[model samples]
Target: MAKGGIKFKDSAAAYERLAADVAARRFAPVYLLMGEESYFIDALCDRLAATILDESQRAFGQITVYGRDTEAGQVINLCRQMPMSGDRQVVIVKEAQQMRGLDKLSLYTQQPSPTTVLVLCHKEKSADKRSAFYKGAAAHGAVLESVRPRDYEIAGWLAEHLRRQGLAADGKALSMLTDHLGTDLSKIANELRKLLVSLPEGTKRITDADIEANIGISKDFNNFELCKAVLARDMERSLRIAAHFARNPKDNPLLLTVMALFGQFRQLFLLNYLRWQSRHKGLPFPPDGELMRILRLNNPYALGELKQAAGEWPNRKVFAILGLLREYDAKSKGLNAGGMSDGELLRELLLKIFLL
Candidate 1:
């Protein structure tokens, strides 16, 4: 069958597939790329323009519009246009979530032009499958893919992506970039691009020292180092990093770091349980790669460490730890009497994690 739906683990794979499909001129009547991850969506759309449409056709037939600026009537008009010296014309509606006449466009979609390709890019969420537009698109054989990248996978991908750019970052540098950027690819790419432009040609190795020097983050004090300190159970380093965050809450917000730390611990606990029971029963913990894919966990020692740590805790302690994080989250947002600096609060939280 020529029509099918597939999801990739991350943006790189998504782009690779999109390029291949577009190269083969296997364009679908309707293509829906929806996700919080914008990099792949942008790249896929760009690929369609650069490769699928010839220069002369693009001048007259390829139309790129934004939801906030363009109306649905214009989109429908473009869709109805005859291709100029090309097999098909492309209509890309970005931020399609903001399009005013999406309901109107649905009527035209019932019998779309075979010589036209419509791509709707909605970054926040998917168009409701029950809606007329979604239904019409699918009934006419559309290609739909969701581009959500897991947090852990981002770190791993960053390293590989950097290598492709002829730049190399060690594990610590990659980890630091993830911590500093907070899992946003656009921002990360922007920052990395800035770094590369300023670097000498043929520069390959990027270290923690170079990052701190260039990015203005303290080498000894950052989210990655703090997370490592907590994971390693080095309370002193954790407290020191907390103190730094407390002093400069604007730079290293306490809420984000706390959330990241707790997320890591929660993943460890889950994997811990999975390892213990799955091994004894001789059954796959995740039954497949489902849990691994979802968690984005890759460390060799991760399962073993989690098993050891989980064995030391009772169920009540796990619940209590979660409760503590919830309380802190609320208090941090000014729900309670939250006067203390993030560093002091994080220090207390690190102590709690260590105790657990």
Candidate 2:
């Protein structure tokens, strides 16, 4: 197993090490997996529990405990015991964040048993970095910090996920999935798995049609397409899509639509600000690589449209549009909204954005 530094590591890097160790049967003394992103933590835990020992060995060697039902001292006691029927014992602590006096485990973490593989599944928050337990784990074992990916990064993540499954998705399909599913990795993964299962054998590519057919997301009238239409100032197409959304309020929640627009306009506002800085202050726009890195933009193709929009929309207009989005977002949440239907608010917001 790869060793961790005296600090937390990013989820991807941490999971890579955990996966490698599990695959090789190289057990670490302790694994402190903590974060808001539970998917990776749960996944690593499942793999460890399933792969560390054979069924017969596991019957005696594997121990699973819930933090709410156990204390740090009990966990420490369990970690100290010798394996009964195998070369090593696997002790998994799920929801470790709920364990009272988790800091008390510092004493045991300082010198964990080499024959014991202690797994801590701390969900929804990270361990305290300043705590002795965190330091001890980092020194003796490994710490994995799972974080939720941002909205713009989802498409890239989905694409990579599909690639791993021997399937590929185009930009439009990626956009449609992200737009509809938002940034919940678990949900997105589940939906993609369903799509993959629905496909014929040896079908390697996922297209808009596949998405539309399997996921029930429209290829032409989704929020992704709506954003493109509005950015291109294609009023007819933009209003048409908005009308579709207004009609299908159940699938296309008005709040989500407004938030999507808000995100789009916010991106445009940033692009406009960068362009202005480049022209007036002699500052350069970030290189494509840096721009994607800083902006969390996975698709470079979207940059072309963004660049064009940045040139077309002045800073003032971008600012105004942002303010309007904010207002409509509030109204969509029923803040100062005088009983207007979601469809009405959406239509009104679209008109105002188009005018801007």
Candidate 3:
């Protein structure tokens, strides 16, 4: 058991640490897991509860309390109490942002009991780093930091996770998964687990076909198909998928779809420009190969259609499309369009891309 403890500078780092801890069984005394991604924080808390704490001892000192429901002083009192029938006791506090008198808890954290493991789960965007509670936890206990995932890193994370689970997915499938799921690691992990379990053990590869069949998406309709259609300039198929996405907002969030599409386009555009460069004559387009070396990550599909698109359109047109994408990105968030339905927004963007 490695008890050196993992210090996550960001949310992705937090998940990686949690994954490692789950595998290694090195539980810490005070875990301050705070992040915007509720799923990761909640999952880590659940893992500790289910896998770490013993039942008889749980009754004596395994207390689960919410910040809104109890005061910080009360939690401190619970922590001060002795454990029963076990060498260690666990105390989990959810939504630590709502708890009152946390400043007092800060004072108590200076000398946290070795026998008690106090877990504070803070909600996303709510925990104040400047507050006494956060400072106290960092000063005295272990802190699991959480930072939002950048768009570029999400695809690689998905691929790496699949590899860890003894499963492989093609670049197309990986891209599609990230596109649909957004940058939520917890959700991505859950979906991948579902896919892994549905198949026989020791299954090594996952395809776009397998993903579509096992996941909630329809067999014939998905972001991958849509991207292919758009790249081929198949306006009819693009409209069909966009219309379906428009109808089912929950199944296909418009904002996420927009982000996914524009992200692909931006990457493609970058790849296309790289292809045009004599410096990259022997290099792959999209520069995925080069980027992987620079970023120290695995990504082989970087130079896909973007390089071709750059060659297909004049420099002016490519710049115009980029501008249009930026406008659409803002409009999807209701920034430019004060009042517009999701379907109408999708329809407008589709038309813009088609005409461009």
Candidate 4:
């Protein structure tokens, strides 16, 4: 789960199941869509709003409210009433996290009307589990926790997102998309929507060329190549890419570069450990598929770069490089840099890493 420090367990599977149910028009009495991942909350809430009411019914049957402007009693009162001109009523409460005295709404849970679909969208954090409303909502309907997917799980999540759009990304395209866009699902989805609008009709498979031309992330001078160059100890190529980044700071942020390098070194560090375990401890190496999953990789052949990089640096050196990454990550955030530019800081960090 990517909702770091949140106590709730990963809710990705529940999200999928609930989405399927909502798509099939399986309406629950009361839904508490609360979690750190607001993207999931918004997507599901929008789906419910779009699917639950017909165009003619929205004027009278579909009602929307915000937390700041209303109270729990008002919401409950709305839920208690019968639909104006339809059999079913859909009440969507957006940003319910800001609403005070939400627990007071629990009074209605005991006799929740079967004709009302009350959706409470509490996002960016989990709700108070001890609240009567939380317990009542869970017992009466659903408390969907929209947990964010971790770094390793994001690719799969993105793939599923694309699959739902009736599109797919080739392996290279997927890597480029994830690496360039990072794990912000809303941004990724927005980009995909825009890219789809720009592409020729009948285009289903997003290719590297499409990403490069449409998204403007270079297939050549991206952080992916820079990480590969650093891992392979190609100082010349690393410096060259760093220069390109220096020239185009908007396109190549140093912070993202640091993150990419950190991810690469993390994989290399783990690969080094596995290799040592196999050679010294007489443990069998993980199969290619298992190793791929560990690294969150799409291509089996990509293992060659990781294995080769592991051999190029010792464990201690990888640790030192990781330390460099952390230091630069901070420097990129203006922590202790004596006025060095982001590009300059990145260049210095790479040099220090390679020297390790």
Candidate 5:
């Protein structure tokens, strides 16, 4: 699967590499942090902002300016100033993309301050590649461009994040968090921090229980159960779960719910397609090993429910369900949707799912 951020081998590798540099006290002359993934960009910038210069030196040696508040000229002048407290100084530019005439940074990069570590944090999107500022940052120092991790990639990221905090998570817990949090690393990291702090001391492994208790995600009524409920063709059970989600809209958003269903249906479609191929070719059914790889399943039992669902639902029906999911997903985002509430939309969608 596709992993790392843009230009890196794995999604987390870019962040880890830069973090290691920060930990090693290896400061670059100019750092350009650009990414759709704000988490790593912010994390890396925060580490540099907090470290690099000591508290005493920060009074005169550090300056943080926002792109909306400051221009390239002002930042350049600040960066060129000599440190008053010590030999090293730090100049951090947050939301750098919002800075007017940001390409003017190329002028400063040509003659960067010897005693300063200048960091430009471009959040939400990357800076223009053809711009001189990007080129100059590359010529002068380091640039970290992070792409958003996919849902599958987030599991590995969450594991590493927990490992650094002296914690681990179970397979089920991993699925719950990834589905709930999706690809937003900052949100996931924030929730995890809150979760970790609230846990009793000496807790080493995170389980579905920990998530349910601390994070308030009901392991019994979450999207996993919703998927299971639908697979079993239990309309009553499915509606009950939908009611639970409606009660806790803060925890179970409609978009996330729609996304979870899409993922489940996609997996079912693949399984049904495989089965169809086996039948047509007069070959033996594909084994669990191949199914595990195709489904990206971590455990054997995860397949049991999916296998059952695939058998019950034909490939054509599953394909149509995927289309229906996309339509509802758009409606959830207010595309061609009237004043229908999320609950209304979801209730209608579930009824249609059963009809299909």
Candidate 6:
């Protein structure tokens, strides 16, 4: 468990520790949940709400209040109240970031009631580190910073989430979800839940077909497949995928496609530079772990393809393709593109990438 000023590699790790503590019925005097990601914070709050008190105990002990309706001084007074019929009282302040005089809570936090569990749900923002309230909470209780996962980390997190549900997904299916859904954890979890429910009781595995059937993500013509085709330099497949995307412009926006291509080519350029440095400058090629970290690639399977593509596309070609991708990205955004439809722009971009 980390103390103050913590940076988790992913949200799941932070959730795991909190879940374990809550499950064990071990809690601190105060919990300050603050960060950009609300999914984990919301999950922890939900779990705490449901688990900390039973139906009978909740009626007497659990008090849920909103920050806008209550003051920091009122919260302290409530915390001072004794549990009617339980050992401890749980006072949850939702959206505590909006509470006026939040800093004044430091007065009570400094000598908090050992019999009260104060949960402050400060979503999407951090408390002032120098404030008395923040320092007091850090010294007396736990401070969980719920940061969102980066784009690359989503696939691995989704895979692990599926495994916990007794469901399995392949790399392609995982990539399809990641690419289509992006980094919105709440939406991804909801969709996966729907997919899980759609499966028959005995069904254990989720495939690209399952995703397509359940979530409307195409198995063959999606952005994941398009990127794979481009990385392999398969002119025929790349053009075909681009044409499919052109036909379904709503699903495959030209800007997103161009951005994906730009990222792939950028990775290749970096890999080329690193390889050059290793060859002539006596620097060793980074180990697999280091390479993945440097490349910001969470999918090892995709990393393999990227490494192969780097070898196939020379540094000079990668540079040129990057420039072309940048131009197309701007054009797709309607910067200087005169009247080109998304389809025509996509087709033109594919031609340039294939030729390069």
* Deviating ranges (above 4 Å) for candidate 3: 1-10, 18-25, 126-132, 243-250, 272-288, 291-302, 334-344
lDDT ranking, high to low: 6, 5, 2, 4, 1, 3
TM-score pick, better of 2 and 4: 4
Better model by TM-score: candidate 4 vs candidate 5: 4
lDDT of 4 by residue, 1-356 (tens): 33334422346667778889988989899888998777778888888898888899999898899999999899989998998987999899999988878778889765689999999999887887787778888899987887765655666777777888899887677777777777777888889888899989998888888999999988888887888788779999999999999999988888888888888888888888988999999999999899998886766667877876687888899999988889888988899989999889988988888777
Tell me the number of clashing residue pairs for each predicted model. Answer: 1, 0, 8, 0, 4, 0
Which clashing pairs does model 2 show?
A: none
lDDT of 6 at 88: 90
lDDT of 5 by residue, 1-356 (tens): 31232542353786788889899998889999887778888899889988898777787888888999999999998888888788888999999989998999889876788888999999877887788878888888888887876665677677878888788888778878888888888889899989989989999999999999998888888887788789889999999999888777887889988988998888898888778788898867778998887886665777888886677888788888999999999999999778887888888999999998
Clashing pairs in 3: 10-147, 11-147, 268-306, 271-286, 272-306, 272-307, 285-303, 286-303
Writing each residue's lDDT as its tens digit, candidate 6 over 99-161 gives 999999999877889989999999877788899999999899887888777666787788787
In terms of lDDT, the best-performing candidate is: 6
Residue 53, candidate 4: Cα error in Å is: 0.9
Best by TM-score: 4
lDDT against the true structure, per candidate, is 0.73, 0.84, 0.71, 0.83, 0.84, 0.85
Go through the candidates in order and give the C-alpha RMSD of each one to the true structure.
4.9, 3.5, 4.8, 2.2, 2.9, 3.1
Error of 6 at 346 (Å): 3.1
Write the residue-wise lDDT of candidate 1 on 232-307 in tens digits.
6678888888888888888887777866666766776676666767778787767334665555654434444444
lDDT of 5: 0.84
Off by over 4 Å in 1: 1-15, 23-26, 54-57, 68-71, 83-88, 139-142, 157-169, 198-206, 267-296, 301-319, 351-356
TM-score between candidate 3 and the true structure: 0.82
lDDT of 4 at 138: 84
TM-score, cand. 4 vs. native: 0.94
- lDDT by residue (53-148, candidate 3, tens digit) is 756566775889998999978998888887875777889999887788766777667778878889988877435567787777778776765655
